[model samples]
Target: MKKWIMLSFLLIYLAGCQPFMGGQAVIDWVDFIQWNGQEYNGVHNSEIADASFIEKEIGEVRFKVADNVSNPSYQLKDGDAAFHEKGTKLYSIKGKDNIIAVKDEAAINGYRIYFAMDNSKYKWHFDDVSLEQVKKIEIYKSATPAGNQQIATIEDKAGIENFLEILSNSKEAPAFQPNTSTGDPISYQIILYTDEPITYKYSVHYDGNTYFWYPSETAILSDDIQHFISEK
Candidate 1:
């Protein structure tokens, strides 16, 4: 009787400590598919894939495994922007909700070029000067109380242009499956201000792999953009 009682207690303890015990547990999808071939043979059945048991035991386990996998670092190229200097403050206007003051010459020029190209008003603005003219560029968020949210800083004019081009091409879409551990989607708000007190707001979001913008239907972040943000 004592032996049976102890066995019951052991089982209870294991169940209570399942999370810790199953921390490293993972489901082999390839093996699972092979074994349950008939179930998923012809039709696209998500019953097993979206099962709560599978999510808790296997899906969550896969997420943990992915977390352990180290992502490759982004490589820097010959004209990539350097990290911003410490204590740099982003300027904000008094009455404007999203207006910001841009002092960096290169960033100012880049914005002008971006706006001109976006409106199709003046394609010749960039024709006069080469991208090599701009040495460095940086973007900062004006929403924070301290106004010190520096998003990205790039030194290569070509890199900045590429970034702008991506922004100009993105289009809006409905939300997709998010890959975050918290199960919440990641979002970004890019605010740009011009001397005319004009404000441009761009909304970007991450679907685990890449960052996409809504308006232009473009992917602003590729390997290079990822590297730039990560490096900073």
Candidate 2:
């Protein structure tokens, strides 16, 4: 009798613990399937099924982006990189290894910092893009790190530790709001996901209309710069 009762309770708990439909777990990707009113064309003396089946698949992925300007280290990819989007002068930095892409330093809106580690292929892949995950980024148009500004210098000793703590405890990547800093009417956002630990850093800039997503990875050469420039 005790065993039966324990088993019953365990089953009930497990049922409630089941993840959301379509494997909506923090680590699993799901595919959506739509059955068309068609038939499977193949037949073994069987009539063609009058249904079309469309399956949407999503894979588990993870991404991370870190602003470690002091560390001259990274893993790079030597692939054909380009800014495929139109109307914007977005750029990307990439190469075959981590160090090749590391340059002396670069500046965005007067701040010199290293590229965020996000463009590598080995770590980041999305089987399906979730419309619900997309967000309208808010760029801090004249916000700067001042006495009363929200932009905090991440270079301090405890700053890095605090940032890492946030990442470890967060269910998703924390969004960066430029409102904390004063700058060239521009701000950056770092997006993260739980599928896989692949990071993509973005700099958002507007030209009167749409906002652009500039890849934050560093380039190995002038040619490499051409690969990651994109507009969205």
Candidate 3:
């Protein structure tokens, strides 16, 4: 068996820039692979409906392995994103209500992305996943940045403090003002905080979909947060 090792820091983000204090983050899409040659019917909840029998219930996420008759460690192709290094398989997953990106690179490498169910509060399980009837997976999109939207960054604590100070002083931060780009009034703020002994610093992220907030201990990834970032 070719044991897979995790890749760290696919992308990093600024903790201060995020708006939320504590919450879940979502991305647009994620990618994975299937060994067999197959086509997607674009069916709604096709995986979920099929695996209803062995479904493991978390708060909101329901997981069940369909059938693992196929071979393990099948290789997948990485597309334009350069997300996966060569010789990687990707796993993909989707959100029931909204399409959130999967941050797990292992799953992503195998063309699979894992989603967390906050409300369900139960950790998901894929211990006995079967890969039959599934084949030819493609990552049409990513949960992080799309074409027009950009993923910005911040580096040091002083930077975060300065950004926050600017927001507090000007009141022109996205949260208080109308964004000129999309013209959407800043609904929330994204706060990214690094390791600090005394004070907590933050930034303002005004993106339409995500309300990110990386705490003192966490790291900001390419919107995916969990799978794409590394904390030191």
Candidate 4:
């Protein structure tokens, strides 16, 4: 997984620059997402939503006049007029409510561009999950060599019911923020199979003190789920 680029700099406003902070920053970055079939590398996604779940848009953005495009890893300013890179995926999470414009080299390889928003513009509504319809549950945990390896698989009726109950009770959290921080929180992935051809995916994140599902839905992992992590 690509860690988000954290550019920490004191804002230095300059004359003739855009109204916002447009001074020459001491730090910068330039990278595109590299998708290798199964995984997206070199970019840290702002949301936990899978690529299939997002509303993607494409467009080009000219470099700001003050930005030195020659610098490989310099930070771009979204001050007033223009942004830095050509946007590949302008992800609209909730019908344009919470939109994120990504600058990636999707034409060549995947590149990751970062944008920050202060808040999510919409409240999300998830479809009701039916426990009986879930045929199987695959649980994966973080590791060194394998990265994310299967820790447990649930096929029994009782086990599936318990897991879903825990998931349903998850508390909501603040989902979106425009942060350029380098910290990557630890997370787990769950792939639930149902009677239908469609599959369900959920992410469990441990943000130091609390464990919640990413995108504002999370709870304490049940002992059954935690046991899988412990044993693995």
Candidate 5:
């Protein structure tokens, strides 16, 4: 009777702890996560099902218990990276590694910093056309006290080049999205008129801190550009 009771107790204990043991404790999903005091957000991933292990092995992400999690799944802990739906926490990603590609079929393609060992690739890709080819840019605001309105129109060549320079230096975010949950979103409508037959339309999204080209994967507004636009 004693032997049988001991066996039953052991089985019950094992069953209770089973779900927590998957060889590795990876969360099912997380919007974003804080690691080593830095925030990585706006995660995008390509699901290569049954994909071969990546050999690039850029960096590693270690999950630790924390008090705050902007995204629910992230607060739970998992890989080192944060993304939207299919972001994976990679302990060791393959490549120069850690920077994830964000591709938009409509306008542009860019990259986001993900689990980076250092802040190297965290700048906008700003494939802006040559300044000489640019004619002017018209700026507008969407959420305003007077409703959407034209804010400024920049036709000066020097001003346009200055804006483009600042944009190139703007910092790249790990994971970023337009957050309108608080106040009215800080947004701008940028219609760039160029010499080419194509007139490019971009956005200026201010998250109370920095500005981003909302539809883009990684285009942040520059300070000089911000000032330049403000003056206009």
Candidate 6:
């Protein structure tokens, strides 16, 4: 009776553990199916099925219907160098053998920083900003005749890390308000892009524009980042 009881307990434990393993497979399958459809349609797609009918292999997996009326589809096609999502033809793996791993979107793409300051009132130009250690930079004016001139580009390594630090350390102010008294007022916008992009904008207040992008705000700006923007 004790042996039978032990066997029953073992069966219960195994049953309990199945869901945990199955949960992970479900998550992986969800990722695989969406990725596959993204490749076929050239647009993002949603997952439609559960983990019930996935077949896992040593280095690959097939997604299929339980009844087997439709043909099974290969979701992951593992290659010697990297794991390829069969549908998208995009590499999901990062690095080389032994050190190989899944790719991180944020780390691989780096950061894109965009700065736009009112050209009419402010004298700053993208040319004035320093880029000694920056990886890549692009400068352009807004298509609008009166819109702010813009600078946008990507950075990585120490350059991006420093920029992130500055942003995090900078002081926060109240939500922006436009100057009603003056028809034209100075405005500024700084946009940083990573996995998620953030925007920071400064505009003149009704009373008077109090924000300064230099000396006071300059404390947040690294000397390696830029030099002069306005005379005052």
Which one is best on lDDT? 5
What digit string (tens of lDDT, one per residue) describes model 2 on residues 1-232?
2211000011112267774444322211111111121111110111101111111121111211122111122221222111111121112123312111111112122111122233422222222323233222111222345311222223343433443333233232134322324434343333322222112233334333223332322211122211221222
Which regions of candidate 4 are displaced past 4 Å? 1-128, 142-144, 173-184, 207-209, 215-224
Weakest 10 consecutive residues of candidate 2 by summed lDDT? 39-48
lDDT of 2: 0.23
Cα deviation at 27, candidate 4, in Å, is 21
- How many pairs in model 4 have backbone atoms within 3 A of each other, for residues 3 or more apart or on separate chains, i.e. clashes? 15
Scored against the true structure, residue 192 in model 5 reaches a CA lDDT of 62
Worst ten-residue run, lDDT, model 3?
A: 38-47
What is the C-alpha lDDT profile of model 6 across 1-232, one tens digit per residue?
2211000001122365564332322211112222221211110111101122122221322432122212122232222111223232222221111111222232212211111111222212322233343333222222336454554443556655564444345443434344558564443344333221212222211123333233123322333333122312
Which digits, one per residue and each the tens of the lDDT, describe model 1 over residues 1-232?
A: 2211000001122465565233443322210011111111111100110111111111100112122312222222211111223232233334432222223433322211111111233212222223333344455543355443567765565776776655545544455444678554455444433322333444556656766554533334544445444424
Candidate 6 residue pairs that clash: none
Error of 1 at 25 (Å): 53
Superposed by TM-score, candidate 1 places the C-alpha of residue 81 at a distance from the truth, in angstroms, of 42
Error of 4 at 188 (Å): 0.9
Error of 1 at 54 (Å): 57
Candidate 2 wrong stretches, greater than 4 Å: 1-120, 124-150, 172-232
Over all chains combined, what TM-score does candidate 6 have? 0.23
TM-scores, one per candidate: 0.32, 0.20, 0.20, 0.41, 0.40, 0.23
lDDT of 3 by residue, 8-86 (tens): 1222224866743233222222222222221111111112212222222222211111221111222222121212233
Query: In model 6, where do residues sit more than 4 Å from their true spots?
Result: 1-148, 152-154, 175-185, 195-232
